[model samples]
Target: MKAYILQKDSQSLDNLCLIERPDPVPGPGQLLVRMRAASINYRDQAIVTGGYFGGRVKRDTIPLSDGAGEVVAVGPGVSRFKVGDRVAGTFFLGWVDGPPVGRRTARGAPADGVLAELVVLDEIDAVALPPHLSFEEGACLPCAGLTAWHAVVEACRVRPGDTVLIQGTGGVSLFALQFARASGARVIGISSSDEKLERARRLGLETGINYRRTPEWGDEVQKLTGGRGVDHVIEVGGAGTLARSMQALAFGGRIALIGVLSGHQGDTNPHPLVMKGGSMHGVVVGNRAMFERMNRAIEINGIRPVIDRVFPFAEARAAYEYQQSGALFGKVVIAI
Candidate 1:
């Protein structure tokens, strides 16, 4: 098997070396998958740069958690999946059901991730990809898509006629827009680039605010809602934009804090939270059960994940670099 191995001392993409390794066998209740595609997430970049989750790396690691592949073999007692089944790897392998908290259920840390020719996943940790999605699209579903689904559908419980604000056009934000729109909710997208905002409009976003042009974008959000703030805000910018998100929320509005793309540290006054009686929920990526339910909705609604580009497996480093550029409107993938 050929795998990209990160050298211990080098925290650069140049340190990622494609090397030959012995093929791994499935353990009990595990399934061996021949990977077809893997997608990059913000976490993948942090891991590559040695800045994620307290910068922990016990061994040389293979990067990326979200991938889709065909099952090649199954270990004993793996009755749920058989050879030739097309499945997507679960981002949180330890979390099969219920809500996720802390770092206990995270995937792609010390564990070998999916940037390889083959991977062995616990049978219960993989979800069958929707028959309607391609391997590349399925690769995007596990992390970014599932996170948005969990926040909008499961956590916030956004309803029809509710107005939701999604910041930026990154993978999670774009998925949030698509999912919210499919649920019959109104969507407002915020972006720093007008070109990207136009692209988002083509994707069915009815309103867009260029944050760079409109420094007081929160006020615009309020205006769009006719003096009331939006019902929900997918706060991907975290602390850097938390105050603005606060200003853009209606009374009792919910903000799903999904990422810290903008620097992690900032101060926020408690008065708005108290006065508006709104809530902010920290969303980790979802569990296996949520991923399964999301897939069903995707198949039923015929929603397709927005893929910015696909890179060959050997160009995984280039793929990561492209994602870091912040010019992409959707997920970047590596075809394995």
Candidate 2:
């Protein structure tokens, strides 16, 4: 089997080397997956460049947290799936169904990820993919998709008549837009490009603000909503845009802090949220239970994940480069 591995001493795309390795066999309660596709996330970039919270890995590791494949074999006691079952691995291998356990291990950095032809996943940490989704689409679900679901559906509980402020057209935000729309929420999106904004409009975005042109998008939000402000915010910009996010919140609204795309250094105030009775929740990619629920929702709503491009597995490096190029409006996938 051929797999890409990141060396501990070399943490850059230039160093992501693909090599042949022996096929791995699953142990008790595990499934040996023949990965068909994998998706890149912002976190994967951070891991590749040694900027993730844990720093450089202590050992060579496969990269990418999100992937989908068919079960080639199932270990003893693996009742959750069988050979030929389609599945996707969870982000956190151990935190299955409860409040996060301490320092939970995750894929693509602290542990071996799915950037390989074959990988082993615990039965408890893998979820069945929706039958309607292709492997490339399933690869988009484990991270960006689940995180968006956790924010729009779980944290904010966006409902019909509510307004959701999506930050950008990246993987998570686009997924949030789709989920919020499916839940009957009015979705507003902000992007640096008018073209991206226009594209978002086709995805049920009720309004689109070119934040580069309208720097005070919060004011625009207020105007769009007739001074009521948005009921929910998918806050991916972190401290850089957090003040504006607070200004755009409706009374008793909620903000789910998902990423810090804008560097984390900025002066941010919390008073506006306080005044608006707004609450903020930090969103990490969700657990297995949430993944299952999200899959069901995708199936029920007939939601298909937006893929900006799909690369052959041999072009995984090109996939990473494209994801980092800031030209993508949705997920970047590698077809294994």
Candidate 3:
């Protein structure tokens, strides 16, 4: 099996080399998957750069948590799937249900991940991809799609006629917009690029705010809502945008703090949250149960994940570089 390995003291993409390793066999209750596709998440970049979750990596590590493939073999006690079943593994290997508790429950960290020709996972840790989706599309679901679904549908519980704000046109934001639209919510997408905003409008985004042009985007959002702020905000900007997100919320509005794409540190006033009776919820990528529920919604609604680019498995480093370039509007995939 060919795999990308991240070694200690390697901070550059050049360090991620494709190497041959013995194919792994499925352990008890697990299945061996012949990977067809894998998608890169922002977290994968952090891991490769030695900054994910403040953890250290000593051994060469396979990087990406999201992948789709066909089951090649099954271990003892594995019954949920059989050979030739197409499936994608959940990012969080041990978390099958409920809310995330501690740091140990995290996924896509230093652990050997799915950026390989083959990988093994527990039967319950994998879910069937939507029949209508391609392997590339299925590869986009496990991390970004599941996080967006959990934020808008499960955690925020966005209702019809409710207004939601999504920052940027990254994978999670685009998925959030699609899921919010499917749930009958009015979506307002914030981006710095007018071109990307136009693209978002075609994807059912009802309103688009070019944050670069209008620095006071929170005010623009308020104006768009006729003085009533949005019901929910998918706060991907982290501390840099948190203050404005606070200003853009209606009374009792909920903000799902999902990422810190902007500088990790920024100042935010607590008075607005208290005065407006709103709450901010920290959202890590979700669990296996959430991924399954999200897949059900995706199948029911016939939702398609937006893919920005597909790189060949040999160009995994190039794919990561592209993701870091920030020129893409949606998920970046590696076809294995």
Best by lDDT: 2
Clashes of 1: 0
Q: Point out the higher-scoring one by TM-score: 2 or 3.
A: 2
Q: In model 1, which range of ten residues has the least summed lDDT?
A: 99-108
Per residue, candidate 1 scores C-alpha lDDT tens digits across 1-336 of 998877664477877789999999999999999999999999888887787865845678777888999999999999999999999988876788886655654556667789899999999889999999999999999899999999999989999999999999999999999999988999998999999999999888989999999988989999988989999999999888889999999999999999998877888885887789999888888888999999999999999999999999988889989999978889999999
Off by over 4 Å in 3: 105-107
- In order, candidate lDDTs are 0.90, 0.93, 0.89
Task: Tell me which residue pairs clash in candidate 3.
Answer: none
What lDDT would candidate 2 get against the real structure?
Answer: 0.93
- Candidate that would win on TM-score: 2
Give the worst 10-residue stretch by lDDT in candidate 2. Answer: 93-102
Best-to-worst lDDT order: 2, 1, 3
Q: Considering summed lDDT, which 10 consecutive residues are worst modelled in model 3?
A: 102-111
Candidate 1 lDDT score relative to the true structure = 0.90
**What is the RMSD, in Å, between candidate 2 and the native fold over all Cα?**
0.8
Candidate numbers, best TM-score first, in rank order: 2, 1, 3
Q: Model 3, residue 280: what's the lDDT?
A: 83
